[model samples]
Target: MNGTSDVPDRPRRQCPGCMRTLVVDEQNFHKDSLCADGFTRRCSDCRNEAERIRYSLEAPQRARAKRERRAERRAYFESIGRYEAA
Candidate 1:
């Protein structure tokens, strides 16, 4: 993932779960994690853990975020209304 030639290369690591060797380059800004397929993917175990956590929190978290964004937009529009009237 390190497109820049200056970086030497990513060090390879063996995945404990899959038993596959994969190269992970910390210098690459684009990839969060590298899999054995040389594709960007979270480790299997980590992905499963994240999914479990996400399922538990997704509903309320999403609702609160949406509500906050809507409130922000309403406030911004209200603030601009007086200027537009003049």
Candidate 2:
């Protein structure tokens, strides 16, 4: 027999964030970030929400970094006198 028969199937689990009962399947859950388990603790909805919140919190930092990069590029081009004003 193959190794697939050696391991038992996992049971369905409830999402901690939303309390939604979810079958522990490949399409449903993601790989755990900490690598502590077969899949992530939160469901897709919770994961998406968390990502949205994190991005919202970091929006200002991202904007600042973008502006800095643009300024640096403009400065470099101006110093080289290779770029014209647009």
Candidate 3:
């Protein structure tokens, strides 16, 4: 026997971010239209971790930018005499 019977019929996938092999299935991957396999290259966990880290690093900057935009809008409204005290 070639011993290939031990493996499952479904293809196995490797996550690029973590380089861990896992069976290809909906639970293990996020569907993506761009990929040939119709799934993301990195597993959901890796992608989520990356997004979490990025959000943590940029949250302060994003908050500051949002505040600046609000200030700009308020100034514009005040200059146009449309400001209402809130």
The candidate maximizing TM-score is 3
lDDT of 2: 0.86
Ranked candidates (lDDT, high to low): 3, 2, 1
Q: Per-residue CA lDDT of candidate 2, range 14-39, in tens?
A: 99999998888666678775756678
Q: Write the per-residue lDDT of candidate 1 for residues 1-86, one digit (tens) a residue.
A: 66668767766655554656666543321244354545444445555666788888798988899999988987888888833424
lDDT, residue 41, model 1: 48
Which candidate gets the maximum lDDT versus the true structure?
Answer: 3
Better-scoring candidate (TM-score), 1 or 3: 3
Clashes of 1: 0
**Which residue pairs come into collision in candidate 2?**
none
lDDT of 1: 0.61
Rate residue 73 of model 1 by lDDT. Answer: 82
lDDT of each: 0.61, 0.86, 0.91
lDDT of 3 by residue, 1-86 (tens): 97668765888889988999987778888889898989888888998899999999999999999999999999999999999998
lDDT of 3 at 77: 97
Candidate 1 stretches greater than 4 Å from native: 1-33, 39-53, 82-86
Q: Cα deviation in Å at residue 80, candidate 3?
A: 2.2
User: What stretches of model 2 exceed 4 Å from their correct place?
Assistant: 1-10, 32-37
